[model samples]
Target chain A: MPNAQRKTSKYVDGRWSIVSSQRPKAIRALLGVLFLALSWVGAQSPAEITKQVQANLEKSPWEATVSGKAQLPDGSSQDVEFRLQVLPGKEQVARVEFKKPGSLEGNFVVISEKEVWNYLFLTNQLIIQPRAKANVQGLGVNLTSLGDFDQLNEQVSLKLLGEERTAEGAAWKLSGTPKDKTQGYSSMEILVLKADPRPLALTLKDAGGKTVADLAFKGFKRVNLTAKQLKKYPADAEVVRK
Target chain B: MMPNVVHGVPNAKRKAQDAKRRTVWVVRPASYAVRQTLNAPSLGARGEAAGGEGWGGVFHHGPRATGHRPRAFCFWLPAIGHRLSAIGDFRGGIFALVVAVVAHVLATSQAQSLTVGLFAAPGYISPTLEGSLELGGFSLSARLKRDSLGLGVEDDLEFGPAGRFVFGARGDLGFGLQPLAWGAEAYLRGSVAQFGLDARLGYASAPRAALWAGERNFSGFAGNFNASYRLDPANTLRASLAYAGDVPGAIFQGSTLGLEGSWALREGGATYLAGLGFRVGAYALLGWRGELGEEGTLLDATLRLGWVNRLELGLFQEELRLRLMTTFPLGGVPFEAAASLEAESLRGDVAYDNANGRWTVWLRYTFTFD
Candidate 1:
């Protein structure tokens, strides 16, 4: 009763701090629980983050525009731009239409569950082959792999690197090491937005730490897509199947 | 057929579109073109000879001579790279074929691949070269050699992403009888978000070669401007304008203006990401047309019915123009060849306009590299 009437308190930093026995235990316990909850959210493993991103993207048929820089197998950097439309289902199909690096303009690659179709605008020709035999082009980094975290993990080992304060808020960074030593690059970096937990940018570096690709994902939208929509082409285009 | 609104849409929607389409009837009898050629003199005086060899090939032959113009047949000889040559004299086609063979045998390596092509009517043969190269993300394409009536050496340079952009230039230097004809053009193109833009400007003056000559001297500025937006992956709306050159239906050969708004769609599995657009530029000729002057109309229809884009049937007059586009890649060759019997007119009749008809068969072969 005497301490409650003359509560002891101390001033610390910018605010006054109460270090007294008069505080309610229930309120203190609630604060502790809130802190723990926040810490738990922040402590998600890198693998969990990757899984979350994959699930979020696969929730529907989505389309996004990817534009940035990529490193070629020959160790040269190319400006890369393409439109990616993914229709996820039992018979999933994804189409990537390139608009950048002028060489591959109007070209597209369609990956389905069973096979892949590659169309070259310059030749007005379409080449269809089994996915197992299809070669990864436009950069050794497969454009379609980012949507599948497990596949990407096999290509490059990923770990939670750090988080950085961004204009929108904060973002987590994932640093990855390519498992294939034969590739020109050594490591990669991905920035994921914390607000929505989606990937924002990806950067690949050569063995010397030279930047290979620095692609930023933008104009992402979740929409209903069909296989026929992804398979659109010039009616007169040449089709070749192997 | 390329649907205007049918320019692109689902099959069901395209079928419901009210657009222009046509089937060209090529009656290439010895006497048929002779009758069409009889009216050539008046057309040439009107400067319509600039069209050179589409209604019947009267202009493709030098000095406006007309007698026993044997209907020409084109032969396909695959060369290394991509190039399109125009209207042929069979002998010239034969010569180009031999040259193409020699070029293929000599330069089939990653070093230097050559493109050889020939197009023939009864009196003229035009050959051309189109080739491309890709290094990293940088790409450069060039179409060298021009027929008497064809555009010469269109060069396209692209460096992109980081921001997508393309710079292209096409021009010609002609050593002809008149003041040595010359033309130059530069264009810029970019795609961002859902919008796309392309603009081009150029100037030209005629060499005045008789049929071998350019009749109309486009001595002033010519340009084409286009803007497009994608409503989605399946639908696109585009608006284009061509000044002092791309007259509608190409009714005026010299320089006229054209403005068009078109919507295109994609819905078939085989037609996926293939070449589909609103305007089917030329009826008898099928392929992508870059020139604004050659924009086709609603009366023009090109039907491509095939399995996997392999077999194409042009239902426009039972292949009267012999337009065949196929990519039967044998043994994983990844090459393509096209031969079309084309007869173009200099009017806007839209009903098989053979009024000032110019006939020429065009053959194109494309070579590819990864």
Candidate 2:
């Protein structure tokens, strides 16, 4: 009877050890699943990242005080300061009013989906021009562009330039190169914040790798713009037509 | 931050920006100039009088009197294997043209080809078909230009890294169909920082045309040197000197040296690029030019204003010129139209005998396709 009792106890102890080992394996499997789920949520694909950026930017109408520089073909450069007011709804448009460089103080530029118009303060001429395929110009870069990411991704090869710390905040740098070399913008680099994915800076380069233009966004804020404000510029009846 | 919150960058970043601004203000003025003439011979017959007979006789002229003696020089750039000369003689022009073409072909075998359209001032309505190839920093481009004035071929080659050394070469040959005129030109431009240099060799002969019944001819070589510094982002100050000498097989025999200082101001609010903005410039000119083997000193001034990257107004001495241009796309092709009008009334001893006020107006157009 004593031998039988001892053998039974040993058998029970062996079974308990096996059960303990299986418990650890079960816990590990659950932890692995949790980690993978977190990573999938946090790390986004390049296309997903671009979509996220577009979503954040197209949330509402916005305004900014923009100051920028543009380099000419002859190696010269120009600097400008202006107030940019954008209406990014279905009827989208952008209005720019010059503030610096006394000569252009009163000049105004209005851009729409159909065309771009310039109003000369001195001559009071309203010069209407045809629209471009894409508004890749630095001065025209903003959250207001319609089909901005679609236009860029379709024409150029987009890649993640990696994470960087900018004046605005931590950002992800993305670069685009024209697939069809003939595009006006040979290459462009944009900085969007990692936290919110809002564009902070845009740089456009020519084929020669010279910086054709660059726009650094500061004091960006959402605004409630009225329809009247976004309407066509109000010129006097005597406005000269060109 | 709330949506309405409107504060700029952090204090540290703002301070850094301020420092950058201060540095630019201090250094840019030392070498900031917008545009300076590089002595290429003027392309127009009127250019002979302003000491400006050379490559792009499109807009402005130089002095009317040359120096005390005729001095010539030549130089070479070992870095790019380029030899440069002013070439006051006809032989030099031919040599430069041949060398430029040969060097262009040899240096650029893998070049990209494309087409471009442009409407320049002074009634130059040009539609161009272009072919080009680029390797590293070197590129060679050839263009066939068709305009109301004539049909021409222009070639340009350039090499250099950005913000460092840049070397450029250009040559053009043109034949006018209606007026029966012939012209050929070669130009070189090189720049390092705030200093720039340009030289040109050119020849043009126009037989009795509809505007003028007499044969108008000019052949010459010109050189321009300039030092420029930007005062700020919007302004530039430049000082330049240009010298032009006559070539063989040409009627113009005198040389002139012109000195000028230009203040260029720009407002970029209208357009993003400096070339597309509202630009205003004032020039103070003092120089000497020679004509009919006679030399004389002359002084003049000019003011220029442009809008929307197209319209331009210029006032020089007692003359006023207006130019309007625009470009549009039609059926996958680009087209440009331009009109220029120059009204002249002589005030002082001038290059042209237009004491009686005269007005010249021209309308031109161009079309381009790939």
Candidate 3:
């Protein structure tokens, strides 16, 4: 009777221990499910975020000194700085000054949905052209111009390649080709912030596999701009009026 | 006459001696027997009868009996003269006839060798056919190329199609010596209704740099030199150097230098050749001129394998092109016709670009005439 009781007690202790170990695993699995559910809710559509950012830009009035470096076609590079401002119900204005690589020194103006005015400091002339369009022979299609989120999504088939963390923070990679054959930018990949979906970098490659242009956007604000800044154009700017 | 003088012969004997001394001439009768026996034409009957058997007998008998001086020189002189004269006349006639026949043959042959044809290409695929004639040392060829640059700016807006055509001509002159040959060719190339002409000159060494030049008025001056060496009975090595530049005051200007070598493998029913070449300089000078600093380089290589009488396959990879081509001959007249198909990179970039590729197909026929 003594041996039997002893064996029974040991078996009970073993059972309790097994129950205790299994309980922790169950709790950990529950926590993992909770985390996954939170992540799914936080994820946002790229198109939705893009539209919201553009709307915010339209209403922003701000001025800031922004500097960046860009890789040029010949394997050389260009660094540029600009003072920017945006006004409500008016064109956004920027005074871009190019520096470094003594060869290029110039100023350009980007008007909201209207035109670009480039000033050649050496030639003392301003070339103005209409903002890029979706047609092949024209400038090019700008994704930011898509006003409706659903329309933008349908027009551009976006493939999310992956996610990456950069100096600014985590960003989502989206790559796609033009659904319409006639569109100017045939294939492109853009990095946008997962939080705000603002475009961080954009690479535009031509049909020939040559990188036609690359643009990086940084520094954001929401405020009202002024009339003086809108009217001001750079002296010695050659206007390539298109 | 001397024997008669010694005996104080009579007047008749002296007369006979004198007659004998005089050159005796005999005339033959115009008889069927004589004509048949001697195979000679008969003299007149009257003359033969007047100079009777006495004269003929005296002439023949005296000459033999007296051991008289025979007129051997006189007999042979007429025969030798006649034979020489006949031979000279025959030779002159034969030489004249030979020259006349040769000249006539050349003129007639030249007329039978002329040919001409035209060809066209549709869409972005430019197809061309050309025919030429070769006679004496000269050859003339004409060719045309047409292609469509689909969906232009206005075409895209209006949904239309547009294209262009180019036409050209080339002439060549060739000459040769034992185991050594040379040729020179000039060509004028331009669009049918366009404002430009590309003229070129090419020269060659036997089995090998033929030099080249282009017209000064059209675009540029160019030169090329090539050499080929036989490594063995069935193998050869070739080398080339070339240069080109725009003429003064032309709208565009540039220069290029290139070198290349090829090895030919000839065995079985197929022949294979592989080669690599590189050119360093500027090309297409008018476009993107500002972006290209001073100098650029292009490296190209090719491999070709072919069946002797039936098919050929070729691959070319370069700084500006990557292509695979296959050709199959459909044996028939004009001469044998051939069809070629190719898949090529339009941008000539080695990197894969999802944007564009080109597919090309062409058919050609070759004919020869004498």
Candidate 4:
């Protein structure tokens, strides 16, 4: 559930080039001096930066619509679109709806309190499963785990990978290496906007250093939801047993 | 109401008040549900104290203060009557049966929710309708499923409070219209949490194509026990053992044990531009056919890929059997189209070697309304 996205096969590791090439020689020297001064003033630790990102997520209830593509090992790619609505409270609820592909258009999943309700619109089948089975790995952006610093730390090691300006804005780049090798991906890089600590993008890689997926985030905003509206999500659906 | 996102301006005061109002709306219902759970009688414990089955001992679990539950059946009588009067139209009768079950569930349910869905393939169509009602610590659920092969109605009643063990009984009636066979099944599910037991006692004589578990022309009891372990957030290990036998006859017409592990290898995502996802899994099954005194083993591997979160293709194989399945949108009102092709080939030196192939196509649509 880390704010990680699987990179498409088209992904090229540009971190080294961006760090090595983009800046002008004068600005590079000035930035080195600024870094020395900032070091003297005590820069934020990787843990602190990761926590700040988590805090930014916990600041309110928010919803985001993410769209991206996944490139398969076969070299074919699939389109992906989903809306993530996070209802924060005593029992946090995250609802995801798969859009775009006509086949999965009405597929909906709701997770709360260690349980998940997966509704397959095509079959009118609602499958109830344990929440542990609902990990949001490789999904580009994990809204449910955005505020879960403990979960992130438990699963992977975090390190600040320096900074750069993206299409969005100036940001802090961080790398995560899974503590357990069995995870979906070997490592991931995340970009967080420095101005607001908002996560902007995630790029994941395999152990061979090949790009797996790239996820970009946009349209993040808070929405006030009434209790009735929140409760209506899972409570009304009839439970179907297989 | 939160301030609308217009152009790029932030209206702070309105958003803050809207946040407060939203908080109240969510908290109230949650608190009410909690209160209701606390006030309800411990239905599971009572059922255990009185022993399972036999209503004469104690019917406490039957019909709660919600008298509307029993009254819910009133709505079904008329529809059932209509089906009985038009017995020749068995398909229509099956459709009415599903509607009645949904109506009954809605009438008795505090939430009054019903779910309906269908899956169709060349030469086959299966539609399912279900409804559930909750009263105190007890819940009643009814489901009706009909397909080209057969029709089945299952009723389940479970009792337990939240965060505790649950116990349930199920009654099932199955009709095989094609072969004109009828069957019934009774079972207990989740009777003990540590055991993860679900046992069904059944009597069936339906054709293999129309019967459950592909059991043909047999009357017997069959059930399976399942258990699972979570290796991590993304991996789950599961195993099950099953037993089936003919009634007043062979105690083991068939027995099987299977194990499966599923990993969420690569989760897919999408935005307005592009999306993709993939997962891989493998499982093994070993079984014995007592009647034929034959033993067999099956190993299966599967891979699923999604393109733009729109098209999905699944490839599966077991031993000499190979299958490919696909589901993609047809673009007309978001229609979903599915196709499956399977082939089984004989291997090893044999006097006569041959292979069999099967294929099916399906179109599906889904809708939801209060």
Candidates, ranked, TM-score: 1, 4, 2, 3
Best by TM-score: 1
- How does the DockQ of candidate 1 come out? 0.05
Which tens-of-lDDT digit does each residue in B1-370 have in candidate 2? 0011102234354334333321010000000011121111111122111111233221233322211111010000110011112222432444345446634754545433332333221222223233444445444444443311222223222111111122344444432222233444444443322333344444444211111111111224455554444343345454445544332222223333445454444443211111111111222332111111211211112222221111112122213333233222222212222233333311111111111121122122211111
Worst 10 residues of 2 chain B by lDDT: B23-32
Interface RMSD list for the candidates: 14.0, 15.5, 40.2, 17.2
lDDT of 4 by residue, A1-242 (tens): 12222221012224323553779888777766755564532255557776787777667777777666644334445666667677767767777666643334545666676766665432223545456644433243333454466567667798766676888777777789988787657998878787777677777787888666676667878897543344332221223422
DockQ list for all candidates: 0.05, 0.04, 0.01, 0.01
- Per-model TM-score versus the true fold: 0.42, 0.37, 0.30, 0.38
Candidate 3 vs. true structure, TM-score: 0.30
TM-score, model 1 to reference: 0.42
TM-score, second chain, candidate 2: 0.34
Off by over 4 Å in 2: A1-49, A60-197, A200-217, A223-242, B1-61, B64-182, B188-199, B204-217, B222-235, B247-255, B263-361, B367-370
Per-candidate fnat, comma-separated: 0.00, 0.00, 0.00, 0.00
Count of steric clashes across candidates, in order: 44, 19, 19, 30
lDDT of 3 by residue, A1-242 (tens): 23323433344445455655666777757655654564453344555455655665455565444445443433444554344455545444533433322223222344444554444322223434445531112113432232223445567766655566777887766667777766656777777666654566766566887554465665655555465545443311112222
Encode model 3's per-residue lDDT on B321-346: one tens digit a residue: 12221212222101111122212211
User: Ignoring the other chain, what TM-score does chain B have in each prediction?
Assistant: 0.42, 0.34, 0.28, 0.37
Model 2, docking class: incorrect
